[model samples]
Target: MKITSDLKYLIIAVIAVFLVVNLSGCGENPTEMQNQPTPYELPDIPGFPKNLNIPADNPMTVEGVELGRYLFYDGRLAGSSHPDSMMTCATCHVQKNAFEAGIDNPRFPGGKTRGLPSAEYPEGKETPHYMLPLFNLVYNHNGYLWNGWVSEENQKLGSEAYGVPAEEPFNFRNLESLVWMTIEAPHEVNGDIEKSVRMIESIDKYPPMFEKAFGTPEVNIDRMSKAIAQFLRSIVSYNSKFHRYLRQEATLSEAELRGHNLFFSEEADCFHCHGGSILMTTNEYFNNAKDSVFNEERDRFVVTGDPLDIGAYKAPSLLNIELTAPYMHDGRFKNLDEVIDFYSEGLVYSEYVHPLMKNVREGGVQLSDQEKEDLKAFLLALTDHQMVNDPAYSKPSDLP
Candidate 1:
């Protein structure tokens, strides 16, 4: 039958309505669409690795990083509002010190960080090991901390005693796990996760920020962990003098150039673990013959359960090494000079000493005083002054 114009329009309208109703369910979830965060693109640093360790479940986002930065510096993150009682990631990880408590840190004398004082311990609990600088961590696939404990390779579930449920996100893996672990660790914030979550949820500023970041205003430990991890990953440090030299934007001094040659050459032998990458780390652990005995319960051996890993610890990235003083896993050396001296002449023999220490039999590399000074110049060239002074990584001035 031939349809009238009015009849044809009505039929078309009815069909359109039916299509809309049916297709709506098939489309992306409106709630999820609304919660979709803006993707945060990391800067394309020169000679830096493209493969970041960002988790698939928690992708980096502009909103997430902003929220993470706030959470990172918020002293109230410890579930406490009191000035004396509060603790934060920034309490120990100061940006000026390359996110490490510097040797001169008054709070942590000699750069040895400790948690807030508690009734059980009036002096406050000291961290098991010294702080590692928080930068270029996105490139670190070999695991984290001195012993490579919190890693994707690790299958250990979180402890029920600590309120961490045996779940996907709660497992000892990735930077997200590291965040929650820090909150509960006695030597860190020593905080209760539930209380921390409730406190953040009660805050006026966070819920909206959380919604912007993760699609909902519901503040949980998982989201908090993911957010903080994003911020930590965002802390890149590739703008050092050496990096500029690589980019042809700057040149090194005579001593720095000589030191650079020594560093990459077998004579100085620093490149075995700390060279060959812009990230400046092999991301592997080593027993660098600091002592003849191994008794530290938390050494790499504890993680691997291998006899060879008895005294092994991570060879940290040398980026901004100038600022991250009181060197080594235990903060044994107070300055670069001391570290250079140790590797130069103070190498202690150990049964578990890494084979990389070829000159261990001769006590050390045995460099001259002039060579030592030159080596330090090259190390200092790795310092990214821009990173430490960058306002973006700094604590928000208006934090509540």
Candidate 2:
């Protein structure tokens, strides 16, 4: 397992994570090779947390996070026909409900839909969108689902279903060709992207495991979408309990340090777009208040068709976010005191609000009920509990 052209020149600090996991030949060769790129000097990923993103054609290793946790619990490489009702990606990602993203919310496969996602249907077929829990999924900045429409140009690993845009889908170019037409997109793993590219062309150990996680031994369709985008770029997350009280190694009591000082004070300006060190958002997109899931919409007019992306999404990543609750972007607030009373006083004040959602109708972010239980005790100290029981992203111990 060694080819090292100085480790494929480690993609020179991940040239946009190898142009977002080598999106179709990462080429048009403009010549920038100061020795290819090597960013993952690597550490802290045990249950992941030191703010992870990695892409320069996928930089982290331990054999590409053990083959992206065996292609994230392989549903025989989800494109279809392998179905004995075996819909992998942990059949709606449940690592103890932290991977809660909904594939389509029929109260997710039955009931209780926080981030909705619970498939395994065949007896009647209805579930979708109840599965949005991939837990700070490598520091969430809009890529997965719930109208956020999958991101980073469907980071490779080839059954070919790639496309992304924030939210609003009543068939936008047939849901952007259902992200590379799910290769056999009869409707989510129904199967036939050329028989899922001939089921990885009769897998002889997946062509040197896609040439040892993609230096390229060849598989087709952008190296099988860069080996399922190198197993979802190895889903990273930070060590929580507010990152050991933001690395003072641990100490936040007193109502989670006064809800982490009114969430990085300036009187709750809430760290201007949920700032770095694993708040992991800030790619820029907001609408803050006024987001009743785009109620017959206008404003943040759905990801800047202008008219202000109406209720602009993607400001997630409060890490483990109190175990991914019934929050926003259509999950609708159920706690964190109704998400701090919708950021204190149901924010709707707009001209597309989010100037850190200021003075919501004049009395905003003023916060009470003891500062909304000190901002839900500083968002339950960004809960980590060893990345929700990391048996290396659980439920796949040689699955039966």
Candidate 3:
């Protein structure tokens, strides 16, 4: 039978619609067509905690971590192209020093990190505190920094006073916030977010990396923060001699074993803050009686606003303590020996001193020279040589 004119037109229209739908997909945004990211899994480290503090919004991805490694080393991240103005996270957080500027670091003498030099402060503004090691931070739930200021519990938003708009991602919440904060802080990169973003976006190689990491070629401060944070979290240090000893894969020397006993014993009482888990830190804040007078306003009290926390600071993980020298928040101790001496017989008494320092009234644990040497030996056992030399954590030979 012959078809009606109306029926013939309807068939043509349907065919046209089908063709359009099929062709439209072929021209869709490359970002929309990108594959989902591969999830990054932590290595199964024996005796280490299984929980990680990764934010749901920013899941760990292999692509993200790789991109972060490049960004962490690229001096252009500071929004400057000049050689003199160049500064990156790795500038201060050298891998060899367990991500801290070592006391013997040729650049920053005594491990005191400083930001890019500006006319306001020609010598470069000194960082508020000594650098903390960047290992196994994925498991840290207590917070980041000596004062625990970069925390989820902190309600303060990024201030225009500091060059960033008051916003959600700008708050002191996680490793991501810490990245941008470092960029904006006067004592760090001392950069503008928009400027840095523009600089990164203009780089030819980064867009593809951005696409791989975030399913888009778009580069922004938020993505930068997340990528860097992912890289930071991926840094693990569970292969130290101490860890190997725990796994029964290695043996400690007699001196190291003796020091280990002293560390955990009530006589030395060094385990209260630095022990209890394989992480080697309770990750809690305490006033360790470093000084009788509290003057620095950047202590834990600044974050918690509690009087008792006046001079308190987060007990940093001691996994790479041997490498990360010029100890304490202010880099007060030049060497581990000085630190041990202070804890052994130089502890000053103060009401704010943590109760865990049981021998504070007696000026410390009062260990002998032999005991100090033994303790030093034990501390060295905690060093992870692999971490300091890991190629994955090192700066890429070629950066965009």
Candidate 4:
């Protein structure tokens, strides 16, 4: 058993390797590799359709959603760490406003939000369109945003599909794609992805949270995007008085009941676009006679490349629609009364108008004042107070 020089050297090498492996925590207790994320259970909403459009690559998880909630509210997610320059998704999409920049939102005067200040631009750039609510997004299988630009199929299609310059990246295929776009967009965060990643990675608290969520301490744009998307998807709203009435747990007031009938009746004809048990929206695009002119590049026509789609926008959910005002893509209507008035008499004729607008020829449905009041009551019944005050969706108090 006497060791030769070669055998002795081999034994020493083995011992040294073992020591290094143990020191690096790669041996027995590999906690890093065991950092598996716990699956998040989506709430069971009554009467809502199932089979949500969650991506397989990035499944929902408790830790991931928690991390996303923090990032969703954190201004640091913007490309820079400076307080003045920092802007978060929550800046425009507040909980009180049904995740939209409400007409009264302090940060967004007249419900318009601008990004970081810049000397080059001088005047800060504002978002081209009004903010859309983020709740019940899991059900929007066709796409995200007003024009359905962020879609599952479009990710592979690239910018050419949308008629954008070939050189421009057409990476928008899902909600995750919005992260990078907002960071780089001059009107959003006015930031760079690399800088954002670096900033988050450098934060002492975030790396540990990232590890818990993704099983690695490494923080990157992809992980951040996935996390935020999860949080956004988890923001379901089905606890309204209307929802309770549907579940047989409560009863609607007489006014709300009358409004409900008016909304569904042929007189109002409101269920065509904004109907569905859980979502309150068909999630389809329509011109809706918002404007006769279809010049904006953000219109649905940009995505479809069809002239008929001009001035078309997605039919937003009526769930929490009462809180998310001013109504329409541009936030033109100041209140539900104005919205009802527009639908009553403000119908503009357009070749691209949705075929479902049966009363378009008559300008609008022309509901009586009493009927309009009832319809507004019905719309307000869809408002979920629980959604706006949910602690889970609020900003993490631990964050500075």
TM-score of 3: 0.91
What lDDT is reached at residue 46 by model 1? Answer: 65
Per-model TM-score, in order, reads: 0.93, 0.31, 0.91, 0.88
lDDT of 3 by residue, 1-400 (tens): 9999999999999999999998898667655665568889889887788788999999999999999998999999998877887778998899998999898888788888887777877888889899899989999889899999888798888877686777878988999998888887778887767888998999899999999999889999899999999999999998899999999999999999999999999999888899979899999999998999999979999898988998999998888899999899988898899999999999988889889988998998999999999999999999999989999999999974
C-alpha lDDT of residue 230 in model 4: 93
Give the top-scoring candidate (TM-score): 1
- Regions more than 4 Å wrong, model 2: 1-135, 138-147, 151-216, 219-221, 224-230, 236-238, 242-252, 257-286, 289-311, 320-348, 351-359, 368-380, 383-400
How many clashes in each structure? 0, 63, 0, 0
List candidate 3 segments past 4 Å from native. 1-34
- 314 Cα displacement, candidate 4 (Å): 0.3
Q: Which ten residues in a row have the lowest lDDT in candidate 1?
A: 160-169
lDDT of 2 by residue, 128-247 (tens): 333345554454444445445445544323232333233322122211223233433433444443445455546665666555655444655444544444445444556777766556
TM-score result, candidate 4: 0.88
Better of 1 and 4 by TM-score: 1
**Which candidate wins on lDDT?**
1
Relative to the true structure, candidate 2 has a C-alpha RMSD (angstroms) of 20.5
Name the lDDT of candidate 1. 0.91
lDDT of 2 at 131: 36
